[model samples]
Target chain A: MRRFHISRLIMLVAVVAACSKKPPPAPPPAPAPAPTVNQDSIDAARRAAEAAATRAREAAAAAAAAAAAEASRMEAARADARRKLDAAVYFDYDMDEIRADQAATLDAKVPVLNANADIRLRISGHTDERGSDEYNIALGQRRAAAVRRYLVARGVSEARMEVESFGEQRPAMQGMDESAWSRNRRAEFTLTAGGNPIRVP
Target chain B: MIAGSFTRGQPRGLDDGRAVAVRSYSAALTSFWLVCVLWGLRPSVLPAQDPVASGVRIGLTYDRSGKPGVALTPVVGANADSVRLILGRDLDFSDRLTVIAPDSGDAPVGGLNYVLYARMNAVAVVQAAVTPSGGLHVSVHDVAGKRVISVIDVPLPEPALSPDWRHAVHVVSDSIELAVLGQRGISSSRVMFVRGNEIWSVDADGEGLRVVPGTVDGLSPAWSAAGNMIAYNTLPGAGGPSKIVVRDVLTGRSWSTRAAATNMNPAFSPDGGQLVFAAGTDGFDLYSVAPFTSDEPKRLTARKGSLNSSPTFSPDGRKIAYTSGILGHPEVYIVDADGSNADLLTSSGFGDQLYRSNPSWSPDGRLVAFQSRINGKFQLFTISVRDKSARQLTSEGENEDPSWAADGRHLVFVSTRTGTKQLWVMDMESSRARQLTHGGKVQNPAWSPRLDFSRQY
Candidate 1:
């Protein structure tokens, strides 16, 4: 395609030069005498023009292939981000220990952290109100640390993570009974996005 | 089933409908009071009397230093005499304990079984210069619990030094007894109540009677968790709404939080960070104070036309149980610290007919104590926090505004048994009660936390 564009520009320039309304190129051209119109020369000229057009066509095809490849690469990058954003790990009531089923979730998040070197994360630990305040605060801290440990062990930088314990102060479900408490006991990971907590002390 | 001991067989006549209703109501009241007493104590058998050797064992320990110093010292002078008498009193009080005084000039007092140690510390001396406003500036506790457990700082006039010294000495001596024995000295605390239009407080032994002297008639005196202030409701004028005021017990400085003019029954959070009270602009609902300043209180309960009142926090300050009439009648409801997850906890059949109000949590958070009206009389009761079992505590007369002592072993309440309302404290386990206020109609007594008598506050 690039070759084609160059040839088109050359042909247009040649035609304009030949069709110039300038005075005839001095009589020196006549003195040279009219050479015989050789059929071989005309055939050679036609073959040369055809070869250049073929090169131009090949260049256009190459350029289109490169553009398509770039677009596909961008699309794949977008899909991988969406998958990471959808990753969420849940916990059981009064339990800070990770479950066997959550192993898959941790595995999936590992690569996302690896790819995004600048990403920082915060692990917010929470608990249900079944125990004393002092005990629950400790429980929340443990849960948050548990999640942080998993991520760090999977090669996510420990410096990129921060942990906070909400205890039972903030609940996912506000109910008086056991069911409500069960919902509140959880650890959530929030991506720091541009706010790189890792760079902070 | 333990039957008579645990459950008293639903009053009497259950087959006849009218008698069943009447008896059921009374039985419910009985259940309420039983719960109150049980939650108040829920007795457990003592550890089988510890195999007594046909007698008793006495232990004695005291501080012998008369001055503020870091190191331990030997007993001497007047402190030696007081320590001896204090040990004698303990031995005399317990028939099981026999006093065995150490032999004089004993060989270095080596390896004595349960050594009777004593220290006469001069750190007990405290000077309280009365503030211009009658407040006291006491900078006396040069030594806290680490120095000595017997003596603490108390405010007294200079001329009464002799009696004050003896009284202060006794206070320390009693504290030593408590520290060694896992009980209280009960000598340095005071109990406050309302009589007619006056607020009054007396010592634990009911001596040193004095009026608190405040404007307006008062009711429901609640102690701040720190024991530095008392909050109560008072009607400033006839036909006016009641106002809740927190008074500095020592300084006489006071501040009031205005509710809907009908607000009352204010209780402090376990940490003294918030005050929970009932205020109904539409109908009474529970509220909290942020920053816990005496000036402003933040409303917590949703104003949904439900009569929510009498808010009290659990021992650890996680949950609050209050009385609400959302189910067409007043029943106790427990909610989280921030007024979420509200669940109705009480269901006596007489809730609609007779109001159930004044909910207080036991110190251990195992049960809730409240007052329920039955047969036209309000009586104290306890509801089990786990199984919702109701137990009644009083049978003689109208009993209400029950407050649990810090130990959760006893309750102080108001009863009209003596032809008028008077303060009464009862040991829930022993079925024994004694009138605390004798002369006037005393109501709304708040029990303070265990006194830290090791140092002057």
Candidate 2:
């Protein structure tokens, strides 16, 4: 096919060369040089080549767009993971035993930990304003440690979790009732040294 | 399930519903007295046993410093009824002696006479006179010995030592108690406690109540040994950490905490040379910082995972008792001043290891008062440092945050048994508890050390 195209290209060039000999005053500048090639066929071949180039450019652009969309979707998923993991899981009173309800919150963090290996968590324990501040702090730590144990069980690395207890120092609600107390007794998580969620020191 | 003893607060943080509300039962007191007068059935003499109700344990053990079985009568002076009431109430409040009402013997100041005090078998007598300088001159007499003990002259300032001479009378009454019984009285010391967003201080005599200025949501106010400064915790902001601050209660100067993110519960050493505070940097642990010094805080506890807070030094400054949760629950722990010999003072051997915290060591180094969960209520408990035995002091209320007076025999704590939290002082021996503050929710009562004995100015 290459040889045939080259020979055809040479034939066309020779025909044009002969036609352009400036034939002895060029027959009074007559606009003529036609008879050697098929005009309709040549025009058709040119259009086809232009169409093929246009299609190639369009195909390249589509591929680039698909790649960009995939990157953005991945970023959004990571962001969603961060939001889900940054919340706290609460417990029942005087009980470090994470209730079944609180376990659901901990379970939400599993995928975030698995998907992002570099992400580390800082879990702070907190209690209500009912008991001694010192005691609540320790209880808060126990609650946090309990959550951490659950995360470790769910395949999250232990080294990625740091625990601190705020005790009654940090309360999520404000009151001296069961409703407020229940909310305060919990383990809160914050993304540290990795993804952007919240930082609690 | 043990009920959650904790409460939560929103953006404002741990309001704890401890807004102080105080009441004095004035109407009931008046009605009871009126009924006695109307029926002509008023008892002219104090009972030998001295009812001693209302959690008040009156002390009759007078020292050899004064004559025994002394009787006191507040002589009607310029503010006759007022003076009579002030002095009369203080005498009753002293729990030290029997105070004879002036009206009972009010034939006339001179006519009713000094012999009657002796006739009442009272050997000690107090003669109160309003001096020409508008000051109060009280001369205590050993009626049996027939000699004057000491005279206390209290000068009335512009504000008149707390309006209506309430505080003036308190000073004089405290002097009388001191002269009669060699022990100093708490009637002159001011109590600083947290009431809502402010730190309110009330006079020992229930006069001159005022909120400490220049504090933003201050809590756990600790009175310095010298009674010059207060160390407390101030919140960072909404959803922020707490900072330990030392403010000159007299000058209103501020000294910020070096580290932040969780520093609170600052307490002064007995000597006032150092301050121990709870820092949540690594964990809730106790750290000591010198007052008004740039020195770094020395770590007093290595309780990393376990929380330790409320550190108070013994009178000798040789030991410290604090709350720690090392045994999976919170209990009172004692350690050497240098953070050595860390041992549990309260036992987990008890049911489910009842929660115990807020350890305030007595000045005498014999007893440590703290609050523990009992029957789902927080009650005041004092543990003997020598025997490691604990005694529950309060049963009617949820009592916590105990502070000791200079006497070491008396302590003040917060009780919520009356629906609203209030300050109550209890005597260790007598098991008598006196409500110090009423109305609103009061927490974190810190009794001042003996500032001074008396002043003529």
Candidate 3:
């Protein structure tokens, strides 16, 4: 793992250097030659070694700063993702039709849509393991569409919502009973931005 | 145009229906013409005189005559059209069994040389009167075995439950395909992928496509070996830090674990109990998750000065293959499950032959499929696990993310050969190629387990 860390550190340094967009020119020619005794040359070599050690310390400091900056940027990205997860609207048992209450919940997510202009919403439809797989899929789709239609009608662009049904393959909870299933049969959300970062919540 | 040489029938009224059906078939020819025009030709069936192959091909007949049928009456015509198109596409995609269009006269009736007949009597209960079921059963004659295969009543889901009969057709076709091929069909399996920044599951043939919960803008979706759960790297911040999520697709519920910002390509162990992914604050290394309830993951790699990423598990779950640059350039390496005994699989240095990543083992555990760059473009390639001899599978365009089919005889990889990144399957034996989907640049096609072949109607 140390080797991995070192490689990453090197890559990080390279990335920072690349981003800075500056290249140092070749070093100036050494000062004009002067007669130097062996003792004087040894003293000059010792000073050069000390200076090299100082440069290493500075490089380490730069690396630590870069890492902290990266961490903060990642955290900010995560916060944006958490907001989408919080924006999801849930449904009551086994029904794909959105309840009147969901309208208010769905309306809450509009600001997120408005904020991320390129963001797209994936409305995943799911079902508890109660019904047949076929029935569950259709039901799941209906639920997803209900959520999608609501968002689109609320002025979220139609292009923003893509619906998918998991049928009974994925569930919020695993059990044969109803309580566990209530959480399973609902539509949830996924957000994608800039065609690169895709967040599932 | 097989209309020219029809033998005259006794009833002129029936003859008119035939003529009108034929002429209306011409005027009402619909998109079948367009399909014909599009392909200019469809692969014709093997010659009638061709000797029978190893498998049994069963014919299907649906009783379009009841209340259930009445409800389906309007969409019946459109549904049938789509079913035909889907069948054409599926048969073309698979190499195991061929789907033959219904011959003249009543389908599955006598005079059809097919060894087995399947009738779709009800959407909920498909009753086939084969001999193996004894009193009114659907009989399967395995000419090779010269005996009847097992026959039992199969209960189907209700018609109303099916999204049109197209799903039923694909499902039944898949069943017939399995029964005949003696191998599983991909019908029941689901393909998980990231689309429009979300993880989605569509039918194996790409029908009934829909996104899954918590999959929006997700990346690197990996299926558990048992094919139950999916793990992927979510865009930072649905929960915790940039994390890996394990989703129970059936329940629509999921949980997340922290990973580095660059963490991607999450792969599950064969048993589905644990996962290995890339992690690190600056340099990424392999990390293992187990005692899954624990919030902290055990770091698995400690190679101090190299970049390690894209960890994929071997089928036995005993070893992991990942890309590492500790040797001065990126190459594939294998390590033990507990993270010891690291072995370099590729000795390519900072040269053209080096720089390989994303190692995925074949289902049988013999070969590893991955992508390597040549002439500055990534292309799909396979390396024999035993000898490490590499063979490039694609050449014309940028091809990457190759996954072996369940049969292990074909591979599906994303390619930009057609001007868009589309999934294409390559038959290993014949080297023939066919595109699986159109529109939407698709990637990462993971073949599901061999289908449950016994679920025949």
Candidate 4:
């Protein structure tokens, strides 16, 4: 009985030591030697050891699964933020004022831009092919400025935004009808810097 | 009898002021008489004016209904056919004279058959002979007085069909017009325009079409009055800002603004000492900088919230005409060079469709030509600076971007009349337009002043 106590104590010590290691092995190490022990007790001791080993394995696996899930969540958030940042705000024919319908489209970008403090955006304004190219350039610029002003009013830093105008040269849609003109007259957002792994709000 | 006393290579009887005035009056009267005769309106009696008593004035009358017929004799040289063709076309394009082909039975170089020419309704007969020293000796003969009026010797370079050779031929044509009409022709000038992403130039006579070197992705090219430099805007890269570039065509040297904003629509001052352009970080305004120098630009217009662009200078460089969107839409406006005395130039006659832009001030400071949106199409219109009267120059297919010739009598604009965007030159007096470019989609034509090839070479 005294020997059994000693061996059991030894097994407990060994298991504890293994568990303290940096990375515990998938399968537990062998148990310490037992001298002159009864078969029932030995079997019970062996079962107890196996149960402890199973518990250790499950803890390690759960930790690994948790880490993988966290990484995937971060990736999804980054993609969503990038999409919001790249959304375009459209304008009316020969008009530079942003329509009320486009407010939400531009507002969605504010939180993402505010969260990613390192990010810089380029707001390029475009116009439909209706007026002189020179005049259209100015009109397009006004559209982009309107967008920048909207973002500035919504807590996005003015220093983080840059504006440009493409006039009537670069069109999103190629047609003479309103369907194309509406799409062509827009302010597009481009990530000029710090876009990788965009942090979401 | 007067034809026998003429010397070669000299203007006869033009040295004295009285003689010049009398000769000019006589030429004018003769031009009128030739027009009447050509239109089959024969006057029963000549005006009761004695030729000798009028101090060397040729007896004739006055009417401005027709263009006098001028004949170009076949040139005698190695590249005679090309010379004759170009010269003949130049005269015809002038719109000041009617070019007639020389008959096979016409007189030789010095011995022109004035009686025969008069019967053919030719008031002035042009005779050109290629000299042995690679030059053209052109003589103008007055058929009415039967004398050689003026002679011009034009120097030609070697190897025909070259740009230099063509320019020399155009100079000869201009000399002929000067001798006949008391004004130089625009044949020696060139037109600068934008095609695709490049800037191209062609002779005023629609010859020597070529892309301007170093002008890739160029737009809205403006030629200086001196014809030595050109100012244009560069089409920026993705998300980049446009910049204004001024280039010296003779030296191939260039100067550009180093601004990180949209800078475009550059117009040279009349003196070629400064350049006015539209540039801003958000809304554009007019700014002027001395071209080919490191001088900082001066702000000409600074209206906030409203965009101002497309600047053109008056002849005296004291007034500037431009387009402004101050009233919710674009309209033509004029201001002093210092950005004062702003006045609305275009009338609201079109009623609520008031889109007028691209204001090009005429060289004579008389009119400001611009494009206005009318009935869903852009057409060319000119507004008088004196009377504020507006005249529509084009009514057919879409015409825009009007650039006046140096004479202020011709306008070059982009037109879609022939199913494609091409350059067309319109004579303001006759309302006749001739196609200037046939290849590629062209726009933003700016006609150069009478280019002096003598200074360039």
What DockQ, on C-alphas, does every prediction get?
0.00, 0.17, 0.01, 0.48
* Residue lDDT tens for model 4, B1-79: 1111011222332222111111111344546655764665444444333334333333222213366767676677657
TM-score of each: 0.46, 0.69, 0.52, 0.81
- Candidate 1, residue A170: Cα displacement in angstroms equals 45
Lowest summed-lDDT stretch of 10 residues in model 4 chain B? B16-25
- Lowest summed-lDDT stretch of 10 residues in model 1 chain A? A24-33
Summarize candidate 1's per-residue lDDT along B71-165 as a digit string, tens digits. Answer: 11122332343333332332222221122222121122122111112111122212223333322222222222323233333443333223333
Output DockQ, candidate 4. Answer: 0.48
I-RMSD for candidate 3: 15.6
Q: Report the lDDT tens digits of candidate 3 across residue range B391-441.
A: 777888877767666667677777889987777778776677765556675
- lDDT (10s digit) by residue, model 2, range B77-194: 4554455445655555555555543223333223334443443445566777776677887777766556677788887554443443556666677788888777656666778887
Fraction of the native A-B contacts that model 3 recovers: 0.00
lDDT by residue (tens digit), candidate 4, A151-177: 999998999998988888789998878
Off by over 4 Å in 4: A1-73, B1-65, B103-108, B238-240, B454-457
Q: What TM-scores result for chain A when each predicted structure is judged separately against the true chain A?
A: 0.55, 0.63, 0.54, 0.71
Name the runs in model 1 displaced over 4 angstroms.
A1-201, B1-174, B183-187, B236-241, B258-260, B290-296, B348-353, B451-457
TM-score, ranked from best to worst:
4, 2, 3, 1
Q: How accurate is candidate 4 locally (lDDT)?
A: 0.79
